[model samples]
Each structure stands twice: as structure tokens, then as C-alpha cells.
Target: MSTVNPNPSAAMLVIGDEILSGRTRDANMYYLAGELTKLGVDLKEVRVVSDDKNAIVSAVRALSTAYDHVFTSGGIGPTHDDITADCVAEAFGVSIDVRDDARVLLAAHYAARGAEFNAARMRMARIPDTATLIENPVSIAPGFTVQNVHVMAGVPNIFQAMVASVMPTLTGGSPLLSQTYRIDSPESTVAEPLGDLAARYPDLSMGSYPFTQDGAFGTNIVIRGVSGAQVEAAMIELANLFPRG
Candidate 1:
């Protein structure tokens, strides 16, 4: 009998000095997480690194090795600080330059818009030799995939578009099922029973999120599992144990 893997694991690397300095906030990780969850690719980790080449290269190498898929956002623009392509090339020990196809794409895009395809603008075409291009429908400047690492633009809309382009190509697993129950009690009051319930359902993931609403404390219990029946069973037991007062 063949065994099934419920989800393929993934990690994300957010690259930019702007992000580290709080000048720009990252929305890609949030979008990627939701999309991956629905697609059944578990996003296990996320790391943010600055524009430094060493930092980007190290993170790329580490994440690519640790996860089934690695997605990187930012630093692939036409400015001096855009160095993600070079860093990714270094990480994989591959040669990189402005590939003809990528250059042609950008050149045509600029020409149609009556803009200059200057040296700085051409920087977006620099891609590692052994990589395949990830199409960018929002902007003509394409992202690329090197081995298991996918490099995408930093702009939220562009990043989302790139993710859309990349999603169809990946192999997904069984959808993760979940249920949530809100208890009008503090975490302190719910901890012992919740722990006991969690212990009984080893295959399911149970989490308690505490909130303060209108001067009252409450906990939201979320039960998640690949098997809907198992999640429902645990949820039933949890409701029974902690009946709403």
C-alpha cells in the first residue's frame, strides 16, 4: 500500500532593507500562507533578511535545504539595492546575467509603454542560468525559479500575481480541515481542560487563542486535522467538556 503525505512543506524568505527598517511592511507572507493552506502546502517557516548579499545567500541556501519549497520576495527590482538575483545565483553556485528572453520581455514592455529600457531598467532581466522564469502578469518583469527556490517581486500586487503564476505548477496534498469554538472564559480557566483534550487527540492540532472583548476574557479553541471526522470528534468532546455557561 502507498502512503500519502497530507501536505508538502514550504518556507518563505522576505528580502529587503525597507522591511527591516519598517519603512515597508510585508504582506506577501500573509497572502502566501493563506494560499498555501488552501492548496494543501504547509508553510512551516518564514525569515526576513535585509539587502545584504551574504544574508540573502545564506538564507536562500538554508531554507531551500530545509523545506520542500522556498519562496523569496523582494530585492529583484531595477535599483542599485536590488541584489536578490545575484545572491540567489551565489547560493546555488550558478552563473548569472541578463538572459536574452527576460531582456526581450522587459524591452517590449517598456517600448509599448513609451518608456526607456535603460541600463537600470534592464537590471530586472538578470537571471541565474539554470532557472526557469516565473511569469508576472501584473508587471512584465518576470520572477524565476532556481531548483526549489522561487524568486518573486516585492510589490504586494506583483507578489500576489507571481504567486498565482507559480501555484498551478506545484503539487498539492490533501486539504487541511479545521473547526473553531469560542469559550467565554480566560485561558487560565480553560488551560487544564484544553490540555487534557489535546492529549487525547494526538493526531489533531489544538490551539487556544485568548482575547479580551468588552472587559471580558475569552478563548477561541481551534482544532485542525487532515481527517474531518477526527476533527469533528475532538471538537464534540471539547464542547462537552467545556459547556457554554
Candidate 2:
């Protein structure tokens, strides 16, 4: 029997009334999920909550405690609706204050653009006392890491960049190995064989993604495992069972 390694788990909290109301489509959830998987941090759960303070606070506290890391996107801007930072601080039982480092970054960013360093922009400087800043390259309004929670921007590019900046610091397990095979056959014909292969390679996860195109049914069988050797062997077995014509 193969030994299973303990892996770090994470969750994403997408806080925005726009998303909940379907006004804005969420791109961060899938992006973060893929990035976390690459870092060997399995993204187990995703929650999309409205911009209510209580809702944000409760979700942040719950996910941060349950997973090795929790990421929150949206509601960190300078507008009236932006309240994620304050709620996160409250959830962690910490005080929210204008961080000196963040203030400097924000001030420099605005000054460089010849923009006003007004009260609205200063709102971006408020961060949790116990947190460290995550650098935002596009805009200098810094994201923060308090305990296991990383609060980042809602903009996909900035959020992705922040995730890239933080990923190197985290300890990751073995990267997942995956294989895919495309078959012109219908899913019904392949289901039994797929099940048999899954039983044989119990350590590997198998999935069938089906599609209908050009009046024909097609499926893509994907097998993923932590061990490269196991994944290759399973792919070979699957190929032997379902050879393409």
C-alpha cells in the first residue's frame, strides 16, 4: 500500500455583493484553485458571500480556522462598500489601523501618478495589526496576510500577481501528476473501464469530461496522482483498455 502524505489545504472566500448578485462573474476562484493546486495546497472549499460585515467576518473566521490558509478577494478597495480589511481584523480579534508601511506605499504610488493622496486613498492603508503586507505591483495598495488569511485585490491580474508573490513562501507537498486521453466513444461505453481503472489505481483520481460536438459524443478521461510513476502506469493501463482506432 502506498503511503499518503499529509497535504496543506486552503479555501477561497470571494466577498462581493456584485458576485452574489451575478453582476460580476468570478474569475479569482478558478485562478486561485489552479494556483493552489500547483503549490500542493488543495483548495477544498469556496464561498461567495455578500459584502455584509457580519457575513465577511464569520466566513473569514471559519475558513481561516478550518484550512491551512484562507484567501479573500474583493472588498479591499477605498470605496464605501470596501470593508474586507476591517472585517478580517475583527474576525481575528485584532485592531485595524493605518499600517505605516502600507501608507508609505500608497502615498508613493499616488504621488508618482500626480494623484491626490486624499482620505479615500488613505483608506487603503488600513490593515490588521498582526498582518504582513503582500505587494501589489499594479497598484501599491497592499494586500495583507494575517495568520493564515491573505486578503488580496478583486482585480484578477493584481490578485494573481499577489498569489504568485506569496506562493514561494508557503511549504508545499509533492506536485500533482496528471494525464489525459481523448476518446471518440461515448461516456456510457467508457464508464465501466474507467471505474475498473480507478479501482486498480486507488491512489489516483479519475474523471470523465464529456462533450457533444459535430453530432458525436466524446469524452476526455483524466487521471491525476501525486506520484508520477503511478500516474504514467495508470495511463498505460487505461490506454491498453481503450485503444483509439
Candidate 3:
């Protein structure tokens, strides 16, 4: 019999002064959390840091050592402030430069559009020696991965594109399965029963979400576990406790 690990862990690093300064609202963290969950990768921790190189390097090192995979978004672009590639290289003790392969790809892309492949634009080709390029279908500029760390673009479209490119290379365990039960009762009414249910099923994660609709209070209880049998068994207990009419 082969043993399969039901959970793989991941962390996210959102690097940009804009996100920290409130100039840019982060969409990548939420997007990644949902996608990783579907892929059976539990997103355990998330950090939003400024464009400071030390901050990026520190975060990259910490997350890379702590999780199965570390995903970084932002600072990989052509502008003067774009420094993700360099920071990632420093984190891994690797040197970064504009390699011929990446430069050729960028050159061809700009030439097809009758645009100049100027020095500033060439900055996008600066990938670390220890990294592999991440394909960007939306734009020609490439992201890169070093070890377990994946560096991606900050723009929502390009960030999503890079993610699609990287997902195929990952190995996912059992998909995280979940079921939700909506009860038309205030959480205070069912808190005790819910707590008891959670304690009974240590392998399952039970959560209570409260909402107000039409001035009526209610709670949505979610039970999640790797095994369908475990989730269903917990659901049975939950239903029996509530005892629908």
C-alpha cells in the first residue's frame, strides 16, 4: 500500500510598496488561497511587505523554509522600482542577469510590435541563474522560480497567467473536500452543539459563518476534511443534532 499525504502546505508573499501603502488592493492573496485549496495545498501563511529588498529577501527565505511552496507576487516588471528578480536571487545566493534566452524572447516580442527593445524594457529579462522562467501568456515579460519559490507579476491578469503556467508542474494530493449546512438559527443557539461536533471529529475542520439577511440572523456551518467518509460522517452528526423538520 502506498501512503499518500493528504495535505500540502503553501505560503504567499505579496511584495510591493503600493499594496502596503494602500495604493493597490491585493487580489493575488485571495486568488491564490482559493486555488491552492482546490489543489489540496493548504495556504498557511501570507505576508504583505513593501518593495524594500531586505523585506522581500527575508520573507522569501522564511516562507521557503517553512512551506512546501512559496509564491511571490509583485515587483517583476520593467519599471525602475521592479526588483523582485534581484531580491529573489539574493535570497538564494544566486547572481541575476539578463540572460540571452530571456532577452531574445523579449526582443522578438517587441520587434513584432515594431517597438524598441530599450534598456528599460530589457530589465524584464533579468532572471536569476538558479531560476527557471515562468511563461506569461498575457505579456512577454517572464516570471521565474527558484527552488520552491515562484516569482510572479503584480498585475491581476499577468499574475493569473503565471499561476496557470506554474500549476501544471505541481503535484497535488487529495482535493480538499467540503460541505456546508445553513441553519436558520443564531450562532449563539447552536455554538455548543457545533463545538461538540468539532471535538468529536478531530480530522475534520468545522467552521461557523454568521450572516444577516432581511434582518434575520443565521449561521452557515462548513465541515471540511480530506476523506469523503469522514466529512459525511461528521455531516450526519451535524444534521442529527439540528434535526430538520
Query: Candidate 2 lDDT, tens digit per residue, 1-245?
Result: 23364678889999998988888899999999888888788788999999999999999999999999999999899999999999999999999989899999988888888999999889999999989999898887989999999999999999988998789879987777778999899999999988887888778888899989999999999888799999899888988988989
Q: Give the Cα RMSD of candidate 1.
A: 2.7
TM-score of each: 0.96, 0.96, 0.95
Scanning candidate 3 in windows of ten residues, the lowest lDDT window is: 1-10
Candidate 1 C-alpha lDDT tens digits along 35-79? 998988989899999999999999999999999999999999999
lDDT, candidate 3, residue 205? 85
- Sequence-dependent TM-score of model 1: 0.96
lDDT of 3 by residue, 121-171 (tens): 999999999688899988889998999999999999999999999998988
Which pairs in model 2 have colliding backbones? none
Candidate 2 colliding pairs, count: 0
